[model samples]
Target: MTLPSRNIFRYKTETRQSMHSLSPFMSDDVVPGVNHSPVKAPRKVPRSPYKVLDAPALQDDFYLNLVDWSSHNVLAVGLGNCVYLWNACSSKVTKLCDLGVDDCVCSVGWAQRGTHLAVGTNNGKVQ
Candidate 1:
């Protein structure tokens, strides 16, 4: 029977000097302090200025974009087949447009300039 040859390490070995001391500073008598107290978060409360008013006939479908508020403080809402514009500053509501009975208002959006309004209908028309 032939004996198998054993692999030997053939690389040059070098030792590096550590910048920090390697002395064991930790002892069995030393105990770690506990910081198990729960952190408290700052309390935040919301304030409302006006009373709640029911917006009837407003579409509640999540997939449908039905209402939009403009930077000019104008709120445009699509109710059934009609598009109503509410001015936050003046506190007035005006009917912007009313679509035909066959088509209901699907979505309403305001221009960035706040000068124009866009309304979408179920019958595939944007006005």
Candidate 2:
């Protein structure tokens, strides 16, 4: 004997009214005016597929550094006397700062919670 559990269930086609009836959150107050706006073509800018630092703009010994998301959302690298941060998503260099460094950055790392930045330099004795 065939059991009811072996029966195939046909999916019921849902109508706009039926869907609205099933959920009280749906409303029928959609705009009724026809849209006269022109359709726009999809933008064709190239996409960068990387999400992490790819060393695309390191030019010096890599020293002075800070994280300013408005500049480089991913990471801000300080290159000796010149500091730069790149866009985290596009890998584009966004901000640049110059430090009067006669040498490379001796110390650079994220702050305690990674929400802030800290940098150190060496004059001749201490780093």
What is the C-alpha local distance difference test score of each model? 0.79, 0.51
lDDT of 2 by residue, 1-127 (tens): 8567443684665455633455576556644354446999999876875355555444444433433343224465655555565655665674445557465444455544555545555554222
Tell me the TM-score of each prediction against the true structure.
Answer: 0.61, 0.35
State the displacement of the C-alpha of residue 97, model 1, in Å, after optimal TM-score superposition: 1.1
Model 2 steric clash pairs: 64-78, 72-86
Clashes of 2: 2
Off by over 4 Å in 1: 1-49
Candidate 2 overall lDDT versus native: 0.51
lDDT of 1 by residue, 31-110 (tens): 44633459899897659646454579876798778889998998888999888888888889998887868889888888
Which candidate number maximizes lDDT? 1
Instruction: Report the alpha-carbon TM-score of model 1 versus the true structure.
Output: 0.61
What local lDDT does model 2 show for residue 2?
A: 57
